[model samples]
Target: MRQVPTPFPLSQRIPEETAFDRRELAAILSLYGRMVAAGEWRDYAISHLREVAVFSIFRRTAENPIYRVEKRPRLRQKQGMYAVIGPEGQVLRRGHDLPMVLRVLERRLIRSVD
Candidate 1:
């Protein structure tokens, strides 16, 4: 039998999907749990795509997500891999560190009551 060349090299292959690992999820969930307890967020969705992974926070089931946290490895060098986007599609924060990027959202949790 003749040898057949593979489309991709053995050393390198296309990423099937990008996902959050246990540690990353733990951090995100910690924040999520706090928001849930604060009654600010009600639901959430997670998406793993070839280029990016997203964790979306929703205030209700039917409406759009209030916030979207994304991980883009491509931007790891220039803009960092982590980002938090607001509902209006604005980049609320971006950084190499997940906790730092998430601080923008955490600020909303802080409010004094009369």
Candidate 2:
């Protein structure tokens, strides 16, 4: 049988999905757990797409997401790779470090508790 050429080289194969790695997920889950215990969040969904990974939070199952945390590797150079988006589709924060970027939500939690 004749040899068949592969469409793309092994090193050039594009990723099928983008997802939060173990460390990133751990951080996200930590905050999520706290918010849930505080009665500030009820439900959440995680999506791994071709170019972005998103963790969406909802107060109620039927309502829209109250917040969305995203990771885009493509933006790692210019704008950082992690982002927190509010319900209004606004960028609450973005940075190279996930913990630093998530400080905005921590501040919200503090204010709510006060």
lDDT of each: 0.95, 0.93
lDDT of 1 by residue, 63-82 (tens): 99999999998899999999
RMSD of 2: 2.3
Clashes of each: 0, 0
Residues 7-73, model 2: lDDT tens digits: 8778877899999999999999999899888889999999999999999999999999999999999
lDDT (Cα) of model 2: 0.93
Task: Point out where model 2 deviates above 4 Å.
Answer: 1-7, 112-114
Top TM-score model: 1
Question: What shift in Å separates residue 89 of candidate 2 from its native position after superposition?
Answer: 0.7
